[model samples]
Target: MGIHQMQSDLRAFARERDWEQFHSVKNLVMALSGEAGELSALLQWVEPGQIGAWIARPANREAASDEIADVLAYLLQVADGLDIDLEEAFTAKLAKNAAKYPVEKSRGVSTKYTELG
Candidate 1:
């Protein structure tokens, strides 16, 4: 489903479970951070080149996928609770990043935008 639909479904789920009261922006942000840590843990010890194989393992893949969903769900809830349009925010951020790191200066570089010529 699209992000908007997923957000609606999540809201409905929360309402049905009487969880809306507990889903404040602060709590959601904390939950999102924990989920992000879970996702990062899946790749913690693997060499960069072996990350694909690590994720390809069924159990690891399942855990990673669930963590990813958790992260997205919390993020959507946060945006919805704050009345933010995630797509618009993403688009705007992309535009800003594009300006900060133009193609010629950023291509083949691993430097941050501020460090790029």
Candidate 2:
């Protein structure tokens, strides 16, 4: 499904459980960070190539997926609470990044934007 549809479904699920009362933007943001940390923990000490294999394992994959879902759920909840359109925000951020990392300066490089030009 599309992102908007996924967001709508998540919002409905939260409302069904009366979770909106505890899903303030601040709380959601903190929860999102915690979930991301869990996802990161799975990659700890894993080589880049091995990461794919680890994530491919059923149990590992499920854990990673759940962590990612948690992050997305909280992010969507925060966006909903703040009335922010994720698609619009993403597009705007992409535009900003494109300007900050023009291909001529950033191509084949992984340096920060400040180091580019």
Candidate 3:
């Protein structure tokens, strides 16, 4: 289903469970941060080159996937609460990023946009 539909379904799920009371945008954002941290922690200690192997383990992949889902759920809820269109927002932001980080200047480098020149 699409994001709006997913948000609607998620809202209904929360309403049915009476969990909506705790889903204020702030709370949802905090929960999202926690979930993201959990996902990050899953691969934080692995050497960059070994991250593939680390996540390739079935159990680890499952654990990371669960954390990712939690993160997305909370993020969707946050977008719903704020009435933000995630697809539109992402597209606009990506265009802005592309303008700021053009290939000729940004290729093969990690410098911040402000320092790209």
Candidate 4:
């Protein structure tokens, strides 16, 4: 259920299916993007308020979860391939975002960081 468990399961599934050979970082990244596109397509025409309901629909939720899993699987594979630590990357990104969007200038505002003055 945790990331480590999910990563192990994904690796095991790939090995069982002989898919590791085709799961290089580049290929996995491309597949991850494609899956993200599929997830995005599901909300393309839905209103903001309705999007939540659409996502909550059983079939839609299943599809969304599958796409999310695809993205996560590839991301973990990429980290494993490059020997990078996901926790470190996550922490670094959080710090970077914090610097980019200081609360004094960002709170209660929907504007982008670039527009904050």
Candidate 5:
């Protein structure tokens, strides 16, 4: 399902439990941060260049996916609480990033756009 549909499903699930009262934007953001940290923890012990292979293991992959889902769910809840359309914001942000980091100059560089010159 699309992200919007997933958001609706999550919202319905929350409503069914009267969980909305606990899902304020601040709380959701804090939850999102915690989930992100969980995801990061899964990779904390892996060597930088070997993280891809580490995450490729089936068990690790599932664990990582669960953490990622938690992060997304909390992010979606925060968006709903704030009345923000994530898809629209994502597209707009991508466009802004594209303008700031044109391919010709950014193709092989990790430097910020402000430092490109």
Candidate 6:
């Protein structure tokens, strides 16, 4: 489903459980961070070369997916709380990033855009 629909459904779900009070932007952001950390913890000790292989396992992949969903859920709540349009924000940010990191100077480089000039 689309972001709006998902946000609506999430709001409904939380409303049914009276969880809205707990979903203030600050709380949702903190929860998002926790969920992201959970996902990171799964790969924290894995060697970079083995990272892909480790996540390829069914159990690990499932766990990671769940953590990702948790992150998204909280993120959506945070956005909804702030009345932000995620898609628009993402498009604007991507456009700004592309301008900052144009291909000529950024190609084959990992340097920050500030340092690319």
Q: lDDT for every model?
A: 0.93, 0.87, 0.94, 0.84, 0.92, 0.93
Q: What is the TM-score of each candidate against the true structure?
A: 0.94, 0.90, 0.94, 0.85, 0.92, 0.96
Per residue, candidate 4 scores C-alpha lDDT tens digits across 47-89 of 9989788887999988888888777777887787777888889
- Give the least accurate 10-residue stretch of model 6, judged by summed lDDT: 19-28
The most accurate candidate by lDDT is: 3
Tens digits of per-residue lDDT, candidate 3, 8-107, equal: 9999999999998999999999999999999989888889999889888999999999999899999999999999999999999999999999999999
Q: Indicate the TM-score of model 5.
A: 0.92
Identify the runs in model 3 with alpha carbons over 4 angstroms from their true place.
Answer: none
Q: Which candidate is the best by TM-score?
A: 6
Error of 2 at 78 (Å): 1.2
- lDDT (tens digit, per residue) of candidate 6 on 5-113: 9999999999999998888889899999999999899888999999789988999999989999999989998999999999999999999999999999999999999
Q: Which stretches of candidate 6 lie over 4 Å from their true place?
A: none
Residue range 17-98, candidate 5, lDDT tens digits: 9998998789889999999999989988899899889878999999999999999999988888888999999999999999
Winner on lDDT between 3 and 5 is 3
Model 4 scores what on Cα lDDT? Answer: 0.84
Stretches of candidate 5 off by over 4 Å are: none
* Steric clash pairs (candidate 4): none
Candidate 1, TM-score vs. the true structure?
0.94
Better of 1 and 6 by TM-score: 6
lDDT-best of 2 and 6:
6
- How well does model 3 score by local distance difference test? 0.94
Q: For residues 37-103, write the lDDT of model 2, one tens digit per residue.
A: 9888877888998987887889998988888888887887778778899999999999999999999
